[model samples]
Target: MAGLERQLTLRFLAEPADVNFGGKVHGGAVMKWIDLAGYACAAGWSGKYCITAYAGGIRFVKPIHVGNIVEVTAKVIYTGRTSMHLGVDVKAGDPKDQDRHLTTHCVLVMVAVDDEGQPTEVPDWKPELPADIELRESAIRLMEMRKKIGAEMQAHVDLQPSLQVP
Candidate 1:
């Protein structure tokens, strides 16, 4: 935490519009928050406007109520030449309560782009603290998982026979 200066923790209350009829916050709304946090953290780290290239391994561990105090944190755990892997965690609970439960966790890959929308290089990040090192390793493993899932999805699409171009 001391070495990683480019991190952000955004705290706010979930609004009624973020909730669904089931009386819980919508997953899409939470995802939108995650993307926003990731974008901010990545952009801060890269010092350039970044676009979300991929997001995966999203875990919705608990539910968030409409009026819950939402705590969203995003950090650049790893970085490539042009990409920054961000770990975004979202937690929610009552403002009066002492315990805030973890609601969602995700990995977002954001790529810096130039004026032409082409990928541009970003500064490298090296993990310093033990927790940071663990996060960096976790990001590497998650990237592998993303590649595996992407390959499987491509294979499945190739197997589908709906491409008869007349």
Candidate 2:
């Protein structure tokens, strides 16, 4: 493969439709944007269709108001055999002011898929910058934590119900 394209940035205005009852852009709307940006970044890097396998550490740092310019940036930080780990950041600010602040951040794992919808190999990503290296390390650490969290969740699922339903 040629030099890998490792990042994708999407920019748009926060619309009134995205507002929640709290009068800020809804968290669900931000999540949808994160997924779309992550998928695009993964697909571009892998040169195949992709699906989101996991999203973690989603932090809502600030409320995004309608009419603010929103930017969602996804960077491919690490790659497994068939998975791409993306660091997605969402920011918004008044278009008139031309200043943006991070409103949300998360890590997402996307898997490339073949025409049959099976997992497919993705191009390897090498960290060329210090920031890239740090993000890659963070992804690896998150993967380790995911394993422990998964086990705990499975243990909970395996437990018998304490309360009987009518």
lDDT of each: 0.90, 0.93
Give the Å error, residue 158, model 1. Answer: 0.8
lDDT of 2 at 14: 95
Per-residue lDDT for 68-160 in model 1, tens only?
999999988899999999989999999998789999998899999988999999988998899999999999998888889999999999899
Question: Which 10 consecutive residues of model 2 have the lowest summed lDDT?
Answer: 1-10
Model 2 misses residue 100 by how many Å? Answer: 0.5
Per-residue lDDT of candidate 2, residues 8-102 (tens digit): 99999999999999999999999999999998899889999999999999999999999999999999989999999999999999998878999
Model 1 ranges off by over 4 Å? 1-4, 163-166
How far out, in Å, is residue 129 in model 1? Answer: 1.4
**Superposed Cα deviation of residue 157, candidate 1 (Å):** 0.9
Which TM-score value belongs to model 2?
0.94
lDDT of 1: 0.90
